[model samples]
Target: MGRVLLAAVAFAGVAGTGNGLMGQDVPLAADFPEVYRVGGFDAPEWAEFAVPPDVRFDAAGRLYAMEGFLGSGSVVVIDTDGTLVRAVGRPGEGPGEINRPTGFAVWRDGRLAIADMGHRAYQIFGPDGEFERFVRAGSVSDPLGGAGSMGSKLRPDPAGLSLIAQGPPSGVGALTDLFGELLGAEAPGEERVDDRGLERLDLRGEAVSREPILEGWRPSTAGAEPPELSLDDLTEPAGMLTMMMSGQRWFEPGFLWDVLPDGGIAYSDSTAYEIKVTDGAGRAIRRLSRDLHPEPVTRRIREEVRERRLRDLEEGSDLGAGFRAGSGGNEIPAGIREATTEAMRTQIEDREFHDVIPVLTALRATWDGAVWVERVGEEPWVEFGPIDVMRADGEYVGTFAPGATRMPDAFGPDGLVAFVELDELDIPSVVVRRLPVKVR
Candidate 1:
């Protein structure tokens, strides 16, 4: 049995730093140690998972572990202590089958909602792992063709609705870069444009309402240099000769905002660390922030990140080569292949690092209604990074560490569920770690 913890601890006086913000900078009362761990090197005789990227806990605390990519994976259910209970659904295009399973939302009625990438739908499944029905997700025209509009995060409401972010295809320019550039054709960017924002969907998958959330085009970057290729870069023959360029608005407050339990909004913007909580009418109700500053991305930091990037590329290339050797090489045209490789190489070798990191990298609201804000550490990739826990009323709790034993993917009433991946084989197993009562 996993240890159940007090959702929050009492702390002394701490003041909010910014104007219109409610939370104070409540530092930890003591060191946050791991109280329990559920997954490890040991595997159950019944199951072996590959690349389980998403994990969720249902109302009953049964863990749902999704392994493999969106279009090809299985959802494995396990007990709180990492015992394999059953595996549900396989990769396919049929009913009950999921091609790409990206996100999960637990319905108030105790059913599971899955955001399927391949099917362009939120496939609902019963607690018994039986296929219910597909709530169809909307699609948009990408440069590659039609693409799903649902983002990865899914939040369920008590009113029989699920909240999700909707955006254009992340890689909308890929096909345009290849085909349009090769033929020197100019394409307008209008059709690919989308009103990126929060979308509310009912159980049957009908979108009840859509709220525009993102503000202006303030791009935020950290380690990677600006991408050289724009949609126009490849299409304009001259741009092919020149370096291509691209940028992404920091995913912090804009697309990263969460729908609050009370049907409100809690989102951060690019200019500040504060989160503006808004009611349904888009009126600001409260704001949340802490007295923390972003770490500067110095030259040394850039070099270290560069090394990591290069190593990752090398490993990926090796994996690609190995796959090609086994399944025969890709049948891409030589001209396009050469051009794409050179373009990626140039960008990787010359990306400029942002001087300061984003204050908040990511945030999620727990079943207990506590907002978990992932602070950007000095070393972004370090294990056991600190996460600040804030109550629904915007009171700051202590920072908790998800160390090597617990890399949490989803949080529930009992604790957090992490996909403990085996280092050597990359096989994934589920872990549930109970939260500590006090930070210490």
Candidate 2:
């Protein structure tokens, strides 16, 4: 069974230099080791993978992948050697049917806990892929007066399951909400905000306990102040309001976390090169650090990001023409659409950036008690980069260069790793591989 050492360790002292914490620099491997490709698009039709696949491995090394389209999806089970084991669930509202599954987790006993947006509940399936029961999650009213289910993601927990629920709005609120309140609509209750947090839910879906995990980036102005608005702004078009509220600061650091196989939580909450591992009760047990120089956000970098942002907006915007064509009468005026685009451009141009790029970009805990830390690449905008592998007990294994290795979408037992790949035609597939022994 997978286990993480729970012994507390001394916190490493910070370095006087702004570079990073005082620890050994992760040495990069000259090249990635060979891996066996066991599964992919070549699999049977019924076992084919889909876009945005969510995968997990049970204690016995079986891979369970969840994939589907708009209203349909299912979990495909595969053996360690790429053989299809079984398929579970279907698209429907009935028992065992899954509609719009957002996230899922595999229990040590091989049962599945799925977060279904369509059902607004957590559904539990037996080890034999039979639907057992579901727990209806709580809902919260948004500032715009629309209620949405709080559950979005699920994490494995020894006591039960960890539900990453949505929290309340921050920094004034969305422009749409402000407009609704100004128009004399009843405001959202304070109880909704108070209800927000990480909920430990039992199999019955009742909250056994609740606690705050970590905060994420909230919308704010360039000067770190809330946006000022006037009553006159209420008359603005919906497109403008939406665009104004959608802007996010460039390269802002947010919480990156994952649950270890032993129920310990591993997380990186800052821009520093530090990671903390805590037991199920949230007490710190180990702290990992590394020394390195952070890449500065230069003027050229800012300009490049701004250009890319603007280009993306232009490419994505249809000037509301498509909406008008489809919705039949609630069309956004051309002027409003143009103004929205301009507003977005301004937001991107004026967006503030951090002094240095965050030390790590992603964090994942392997089923075998290892944590993979994805470091920022030379180009901050690029998603994939080099990775630093370390054991749960704070032993820094080493680093893999971006070209030398590709981070697996899911890590499994016995040095097994799975990557969800896409073909030229956007056809999705799951490729399973065994990691090199030394790296594992």
Candidate 3:
């Protein structure tokens, strides 16, 4: 599977400043103490292993890490004390093999659900790591519309009886049509607005309910109309083509959400520092808010964003390699590639941005029913920033500083949090930490 990295905008920070619903200011914690770490250069047992991007914890507190990213397409099982339990699956299309493991979850009954992109299906395994069955993609009806597959991504609900299936982008067809037209294909049909929703699927990959659990959400976008072009413009297509193409604007308020342990949902739909919690049946239960000031998108910030995008284009660092491989080994004409690059550059230069940066950038729900909302940082190119911890019932926990105190990649039982890290030499590792009692 291919991954696209976006150029993040740099910003300044005002750490530990937020007024919760209780009207009291809560400051950010300086750091989180590490309990233990695995798979680093210093660890001889795991020195050769690469830390996977997807991590989870079962009811038994055993950490499950997918090795699909850099290792064999298997799932690694590790004990809480950093002991290697075993590995399940391998690279292949056989009954017990996984081609490309994208996302996975542990069920309450000890079964493992793995979403395999290469196989285009969900692979199920027994608690003892025994392969059981495969649920092909597109077997279930999409809550948004038509026959929709899970698209190689899913999260186990709090009850572990169903999975939250993430569908494709709402305007993906429009984007497809745009690309088709560029390639001299048929024009796209009318734009669609009903395809923005998430469905609840059972362990068998069947829809639990025909209606979607979440819907009617869309990303914000700002760009000039695409200019007209013809086949004549691509006579010399070749060279590297770099561009920023998406339906979302830079630093804009996008969808931030997570599945709560109680089968509820926590999400932020606007730019404000407010979060809404809905019941398992999709009814609004409560709203959590904090008085955190939004950062203004100044002229300097806009110019900086534009320059960063243009710099990526000039360096051909983001999309050139992906575009080449996506062409199926066929080289795009030099003239067409150059013309497309120029057009993309113009669009990036003329791109408009939100007046102010969104207060929250990411959201995660823990097994204890607490929602961790990551606040935007002040530094440039910072991915994980300070996190605001709060209960699902609107109780304010507090905030933790970025650096070593940011939110964990996966929250486990008994106050355990997992962080996937990389050394200076690019070797991957998984760091386990125990959260403070008050925070956890």
lDDT of 1 by residue, 254-285 (tens): 43466665666666654356666656434555
Q: Which numbered prediction scores highest in TM-score against the true structure?
A: 3
Decoy 3 TM-score against native: 0.76
Between the candidate structures 2 and 3, which one is better when assessed by lDDT?
Answer: 3
Report how far off residue 363 is in candidate 1 (Å): 1.8
* Model 2 Cα lDDT, one tens digit per residue, 225-301: 44566666656654445435443456766567777777777777667777877776555666777876577889999
Give all candidates' CA lDDT scores.
Answer: 0.54, 0.63, 0.64
Could you list the CA RMSD of all candidates, in the order they appear? 8.5, 6.6, 7.8
- lDDT order, best first, reads 3, 2, 1
- What is the C-alpha lDDT profile of model 3 across 246-347, one tens digit per residue? 344566676677788778877776678877777776566667778776788888888887888799888875445535433335676665556767767866
TM-score of each: 0.70, 0.75, 0.76
